[model samples]
Target: MKSMMMLMLLLFLMPVQAGTPISEYENLLITEVVVTPTDAEMIEIHNKGGVTLDLTDVYLTDATFSNGNVYYYQVVSGAGGGGDFNDFFARFPNGASIAPGAYQTISINGSDNFFSTYGVNPTYELFEDGAGADTVDDMVEATPGSIDDDPGGTVAGVSALSGGEVAVLFYWDGNSDLVQDIDYVVWGDKREAVDKTGISIDGPDADAITSVYLDDTVIASQAVINASSHAGGNSWQRGNLNEGNETGSNGNGVNGDDETSEDLNNTFFEGLPTPNAAAGAPPAPNLIINEVDAVSSGGEFVEIYGSANTSADNLSLVFYDGDTDQVYQVIDLTGSSTDSNGFLLVGNTGLSPDVTIADDSLQDGADAVALYNIDASAFIVGDPVTVNDIMDALVYDSGQADDAGLLTLINPGQSQIDEGSNGNAANESMARCPNASGGSLNTSTYQAVDPTPGVLNSLCPLGDYYATADDTNATTLRNTLHEIIDDHIVFPYSAGTTDTWDVLSFADEDPNDSNLVWMIYKNNSYTWKGGGQQAYNREHTWPQSYGFSSGSLGDDNAARTDAHHLMLSDVTYNGNRGNLYFDDCNAGCTELTTDVNNGVGGGSGTYPGNSNWFDGDSFEVWNFRKGDIARAMFYMDLRYAGDVSGEVDLQLTDNPGDIQTGQPFMGLLSVLIDWHNGDPVDSIEQIRNERVYSYQGNRNPFIDHPEWVECIFVQGGACTTVGDDLIFASDFD
Candidate 1:
């Protein structure tokens, strides 16, 4: 029994015929190489095959010779009398393996030095002594009597792996004397024959060569190679080579190398070193034309977004005119880099730009601005649109015809952005909302917002905020909008901490003068008096008596204190327009005057002029703020559904009897719709919307999408046309 067991053990240990050898040359790819900062050198290998790879008996070396025939050898300890070349070459330990689609980084210098440089430990270290106390695995050393073991002369291993040296990975069975070269890479200079003495050899007069061999057969020769000596924290990385070779194609020939020297040079790029990680494509210029204010004024500027602290050298911002679809201006962006927050502003003089151009250099619109990865000199005036090197582009027009030729360079399927669609292009600048999102070259990501040139962009809500709202049915859309804006963070009407007063103070503060408040009723600015009746007061645009009375629920009433419908008003004007339904009153109404600032409202006397007019039963907000008041009414109608305990179901109608009775109803709905359509959202309204949202955590959907008012109230509502006038269902009831 003992003799049978011994024979079985011996049979199990004996080498069997190699069944279908793994084609490791194509499966194990040399991905990255860092050859400088001697102590931090590294080589990264990737397992592109589908199955895990057993690395046992695998060898890595930097020595190959071909005088009479190609002969590959391993480094040994005490070679050339006393040189310690053991750390230069590595042999895989018994259980070493690499999983599919994973990376294995071998620290050529030392594990400690690699960790110090890359901030992460390497997978395996060639020198056991270099690992120190770290948990990094160590590779086996070459045999002591290997081919390079000379007794007398001085021999050296690839300690620095300096430029012009080749690194090769192979598999060898010492017992059977079978060798198969797996991968090879050489850099810094073209291949040239060298004498054996150059590598401190003593026996054969063979010449050292730069080539790959498989089972002693020459497969590839490095006649032409990458001549770049990637030093100073840069590395040569493999890219696109494994794209079609993932399933293992051994080069273009049957018995040739897996990749040629030309393939290596074309695919690899000098990129930041990535140890123990997949080396992707080298960093291309990742800049986007983030913001543009081509207002023809002095403050015109363009903002760019990119990786923080990265070089912006050799980049240019080009402007194209719509008429000819040609280059109009080019701003050189050399010698500038992104700030710590990844923003770079190129503006006219006096705007503190990272790069400065002449004032008013940017055209207003029917134009385009593009960022390129080349120099400004590459572009000339009147040159036709060039899309080859465009990194990002924004084709825009101020309500003009689309520039079809220029739009082709932008993101696929996106149209030319209309900067004037918001109706206040001069006071606003086109910016990428949510700040640098929505990918590159996409004009759909931009919105006309209050200009914020050198800082983070405004957080404008996306147009899809009411994505689930049912537009086909008016009641469904109204209900969906209510759900979206409900459950808000309510603040007390007056409190020691944040309150309605605090919200209105910031929401209504003059855009130009922060110390003054813009009165909604009077259309003028007043000293901010902290809710004092003498200076300014909070006017519930949808008066509280209609649905949400402050006397009934006090400060706990959300609808009563909601900032969306609240505005700063002159204390006396707030009384003059008390609890009246919004309507257009003419001839017999008392007119209140206005003062203009921030590009809104400064006129008087005429029937429908930019002045507030009021009668006993109705009040007409100034033309400049009609949309503001109409949107407030719309918000009230949607916000209070009376589902909650203290809430009331408010409604809008064209009936004066319903509003006069004050039974949770307000308005002449037809006039409000006309007002909303006539006065589109301006910058002041947008700023005020953002401010109110900051405190109340809710937004007026009408202000965000004024077109939805007609979608929900006019086309979708239960209405009848009587003599070309549309009246709501409540009017008949």
Candidate 2:
């Protein structure tokens, strides 16, 4: 019974058939070598992989071909197929195996005196750098008893090398068909340096005493190492504790620091190489739900980054309502992986999610998303889950964890939950900054940025050049700002359809759909796929007939398309409003045209303002829209104030119909100022200001700073320098 049990256990633990290719393993590499001078030739191989590997089919070749002159020497004798590698150099014994994280030193033919320095067996290959003049290598027990492999024989250098030609090293993994070219180094393109395509060529020149290592990945992209990259001595050795391949680092470059241990902290350092060891911060979570765009107009999404040396096997993204403990969705990431740069996106499938999650799982504001290392089958709502099993947990905000005010990070040293000025608002998403640096997920790490679901965050452009804080006298501030964002360029009248749509969407909502839309004319929303609108057209809030048409005397000018005064209203309403003027529609105000008396367009409707009354000729903007209209009128006033042609010097009055017909003034500065104050600044207007500013390169100081309207028009704040040549604005108080 005991014997049967033992046999069964052995069968279960035995290695599976080699269905997977060698490339599927982490990696094995040719870490270092003494390539220059041939006499004391030797090269080092490392099992940088996670598991011990059988070397039966693996082989190494020291060869160079130039001018059709093929020079070759092989290691692992019969393994180098039979081509240019016809000759045998030094070889590994029959069934030698390299334990995980171990190194094999093969010493080629050299002085016996040097070989005696280390007790471990070392074999050799015949690959020379630059013939008789090649650089000599330093030999010693780089660290005694470090390597435990047995020694082997050496083959002679086929030909002495001179400087120009590159000596190539090919470490192929396979027996029957040398299929896997694990790694190769192409140095010095001087002579017929036949660069074997398909691998990254590392470094410009070869000079360091240590092995030139690949700084970013497992493969060496260069054959040069910084002197400081090595430890006490100059041998670029393997990581101790078997963490990962020791890589070099540039500023903020991927470091050996997988965040696992200090030993594997970074590739670049000034210390003795700690061979065969574990080190670094701790591997960045293999995959992290680094960013989430829960509030988006198009669709919600989650972005992930792979920061460790692991496969995307059983990984899954789960979304939950922290309050309900109800698991909503599970997105299996099986076989899905981040790009070489460690980025993967998942969410609304239409946005091209790598592994789509149920759209309902994603919700706006206050939710928790976790990267679970387990499979979906193991996940259950209300089931107890341990943080130890979580690769990363991004809690949107605190929601009763042990009754704590803030959700304590299960592994929080860095940001784990998106916090701070992440103004959890509509159409915005929180994302990691300086990305993939898996630390604590807090405000500093994850920030509220514009929704950039499938890509990195592009923070809203808040330039220092624009005026923001510090309000001054409205008139003075207005004049000061006018000089800055003044008329730089204006789109053609033909461009108004697109521009007007943008303006409309910015400041107002489409009554028909409530979604921001392109209104070609009132009651008509322009469809990009369809033809033009019917009765909808651009209505100049400050009419065009006041000597400021798209073209003066018929030449299309900026005023014709300046978005500040452009609006989309019913053709009937607009024609009714025309160039008449704006005034109080209540029975108290004068010039109450009979148009209103005769059952025309005066209504208690929900528009322009809470004041839903319109005068006959001068239409009354709704109370809600009053401020929006007032600000636009004010912007139009200031924008053209400095026009090159003094012909359109408009006017402003405090009374209805007080100005003559041909005069430029819109009317009643007092009324406009009152309207500005009544409506005040709101988000809709602010959005309009931002969008319009983006296009016109100008701002309505009135909307931005309503108080400024009072300061400039009421507080006697008009610019005295440019006195008359103006009207009511010249002398204020």
Best by lDDT: 1
**Candidate 1 runs further than 4 Å off:** 1-458, 461-464, 715-733
Residue 308, model 2, lDDT: 23
Clashing residue pair totals per candidate (backbone < 3 A) = 0, 60
Query: What local lDDT does model 1 show for residue 688?
Result: 83
lDDT of 2 by residue, 319-411 (tens): 666555456666777777665234677877678777676554565435667777777777766544345456676766422233121234245
Candidate 1 per-residue lDDT over residues 532-647, each given as its tens digit: 44567888888888867755554347887888888888878898988888999866999887777777677757777778888888898888889888888888888888887878
In order, candidate lDDTs are: 0.69, 0.47
Which 10 residues in a row give candidate 1 its minimum summed lDDT? 74-83
Write down the lDDT that model 1 would get: 0.69
- 478: Cα error in model 1, Å: 1.4
Candidate 1: residue 60 lDDT (0-100): 70
